[model samples]
Target: MSVQDYTSRLSDPASRKMGTFSYLPEMTKDQIRKQVEWVVKHGWNPAIEHTEPQFAMSNYWYMWKLPMFGEIDVDAIIAELDACHAANPGNHVRFVGYNNFTQSQGANMVVYRGIPV
Candidate 1:
């Protein structure tokens, strides 16, 4: 599916937004495939991983999914995420899976991750 179609699926109100951070809210499997069609799509910066909410979808239950993105400007990405947060309230972004306290054998953290548009 195209980005527009993929977005439509994510916005499906009946699907119940769980408000956990992972990939883009509107991202789809096909969208990911297309997004990666070009050779070596870059993340610019690494993704901010986060855990799924307690009541999230089955796919998010126990697995840690890393979202990839294409080339994008950092400022633009941040601004977009901020806008998403404003529109979606608290579901648009989050941070998790990292341990800042200890640098020894620490688990990753989750946060609002961005992918190239």
Candidate 2:
């Protein structure tokens, strides 16, 4: 059987399998907003985190701030995401939804692509 080398393809940032939305095309602002809305609708707390591209696969990530507890404003959540990205322009920024009842993460996705480390 002929084997194929997929290493090169995987080197691309878009090709790296990191999070829920990584396999899909980059999401637009509207799509991000919709996701945030969904999270809120489900009573999940929205949070932002960032990490260097090299550590994208690692379980540990630097939280932008404490999980935005009781925050229902979509715009506020998006603003925080923007702020996180702005502060860490060279780091991979991600958005997550925390389900307090289940005491676990519900949704996790990379929202910003950072420069390769």
Candidate 3:
């Protein structure tokens, strides 16, 4: 499905993968760690982003923090992911691996969905 269609399905409370690995299933923590490691090895920065459930269609996801570059600590990235999820528990959160070698192109994966708490 298209990104718009997949995003619209978020209201159905389903998770969707985007950018790289869109053809594969949702990744496990180990898989994520490997991917992050590869991104860092390639000198790409890691970034987190989220969009409020109400604004899922706005296509205006907010950045959780500044992109992390030169940081190879996977645990730290995971921690930031957890913190972002806690703060926006009802939104859609994603982990983005940005490659500066190419402008405006990166690997994105939806990694969190806040259930009502």
Best by TM-score: 2
CA displacement after TM-score superposition, residue 36 of candidate 3 (Å): 1.2
lDDT of 2 by residue, 1-117 (tens): 997544434457545667558766889999999999999999999999999987777569999989999899999999999999999999999999999899899999999988775
Distance from true location, Cα of 2 in model 3, Å: 18
Compose the digit string of candidate 1's lDDT tens values, residues 1-117. 655332324345343443422334655534433332321223232233233333233444332235224424444333443454455442324322222234221222223332212
Worst 10 contiguous positions by lDDT, candidate 2: 5-14
C-alpha TM-score for every candidate: 0.28, 0.86, 0.73
Ranking by TM-score: 2, 3, 1
Model 2 accuracy (lDDT, Cα): 0.88
Q: Flag regions of model 2 displaced more than 4 Å.
A: 1-14
- Tens digits of lDDT, candidate 3, 11-37: 453453345565467678888788777
Residue pairs of candidate 2 with colliding backbone atoms: none
Model 3: lDDT equals 0.74
* Residue 8 error, candidate 2, Å: 7.5
